[model samples]
Target: MKNIRDSHFKLHTTSPSYPILASTELGILHAKDHGEWHSINAFNLSQKLRDFIKNNTEIFEIDDVFFKSGLYFSDPNKVWIKCNLLTGKELREILCDKYGIYLSRYTKKHILINFHFGVTEECLDTLISALSQIEKNTLSRNFSLNENELSEYFVIPYPPGVPFIFPGQKISKNDINNIKKHQDEKNILIYIKEVI
Candidate 1:
């Protein structure tokens, strides 16, 4: 075990794995016993949410956006919704502030919703109601990016920290469109040419 630990630390430059605590191990065992029920419930809720979003594509501007899931099977714990209308941060803020439904922001374009074991149908109804209310709200306009002028700046999106268009990299029309589509107020685009 010592040799294995030494080898792991040497290879990764990090501490070796630690054993699970007694309470955590027992919790894992308990979760294993009830995992299937939780999974099924989560799956059902996710399906319902998906259906709601699909039916309201006009309101949500979700025609281009899609859920990260297979045709028939999907992981029940979390659902990744790619939203074209709103940034993950914007969606997170709206859901949390107005409806009290907090969500994880996976990226500028993607929002992650988790359905846990204790989540109920009433919770789902609340979320649906919140979404309906949001439809009546107006979305803020975004600044347009000119394709020719893009060469003057490096454009990057945070919360999935990566550059959409970087300095010295050739920017195409499609790239500009995609960047404009995904760019949100929460994640500010840094203009690095002046800084450089």
Candidate 2:
């Protein structure tokens, strides 16, 4: 049962080794916006992305990146590294305007997780305990999840395209039977990769 749920949590048509990601391998993909941090270097963009990921662990990947030119340089420095990370649909729309990118496919509407990145057994156990207690109302809206909410759901937190919680992967049988128990009330908007 856990295995089945795990499978449901993953991206469709993927396997243990070959996971999907939001970013594509478009070498030298030019930034639609640019600043002092980086000019026209893919390596620099990738590194900046890595740094962003290090800070924001919940983001899955940048759907696309563009360079922004002619922005004020701050005291430290000014660089426009525009990329998409999985996030609330509303935020994505707002960011699209800030970055000058139209709201299109880059919007994020689901919570994504990766299998790698040190999600230990103990961490998973703690998460499960927390998730079971979240009320449907609390899960609604954009709010920081409490220990209970964060712990209840275990996200892989990398390789943004692939899924950590998928169908077929075993999960707590109680959770499986009582899908409504968890607070992800907007489950219809959420996408998990798996084969039923």
Candidate 3:
């Protein structure tokens, strides 16, 4: 089980976003109520995550059911995997019986290195300081504004609701690839953070 603790996550969700998702800095658990997505520090985990996603595409793509594998992390030991069918026991049975996946009735948590979505140390400080004065639910959009500039901090729907670029973070080539992967998805909204 991953240790859940209060964290100083860099970005905060504003009015345009859901309050529940505001302070993503906090550690995450894989509880059903929290949905299948878990928050991991996405640092070294991004490559691992991409590999896991590629490897398990068949497992996840069953019956029109595919899930994003990039969510939970309080303890990196707890690898996050999501199958669209959480309510079904078949998933557990198949994983355990056929693929030798460990089975657990309880949701797992992951403890990961705190990453400011690739933000550098100095920028993280700026975000934290700015976050202190900002209204609880108010968000300052920054970096990029539209789908064209996806590398800049854009908030997507929860399942994969992160990867926003903080002030000091430069857009990596991988960031461009991630955005390009979903370029056709009209629903992905990328907001430009209004830096202080």
Most lDDT-accurate candidate: 1
TM-scores, all candidates, are 0.48, 0.23, 0.21
**lDDT agreement with native, every candidate:** 0.64, 0.34, 0.37
Once model 3 is optimally superposed onto the true structure by TM-score, how far is the C-alpha of residue 110 displaced, in angstroms? 14
RMSD of each: 14.2, 23.5, 23.6
Candidate 1, 35-55: lDDT as tens digits: 888778877997788888887
Instruction: Report lDDT (Cα) of residue 15, candidate 3.
Output: 37
Q: Candidate 3's residue-wise lDDT over 1-196, tens digit each?
A: 1222232233343433334553442434333334323233334444344354455332222122234556833433233443331223544454456444434542321111133344344533443333232212122222243333433343342236454555445667665555555554533433433321
Instruction: Provide the lDDT at 123 for model 2.
Output: 39
Query: Considering summed lDDT, which 10 consecutive residues are worst modelled in model 2?
Result: 74-83
How big is the RMSD of model 2?
23.5
Provide the lDDT at 145 for model 3: 35
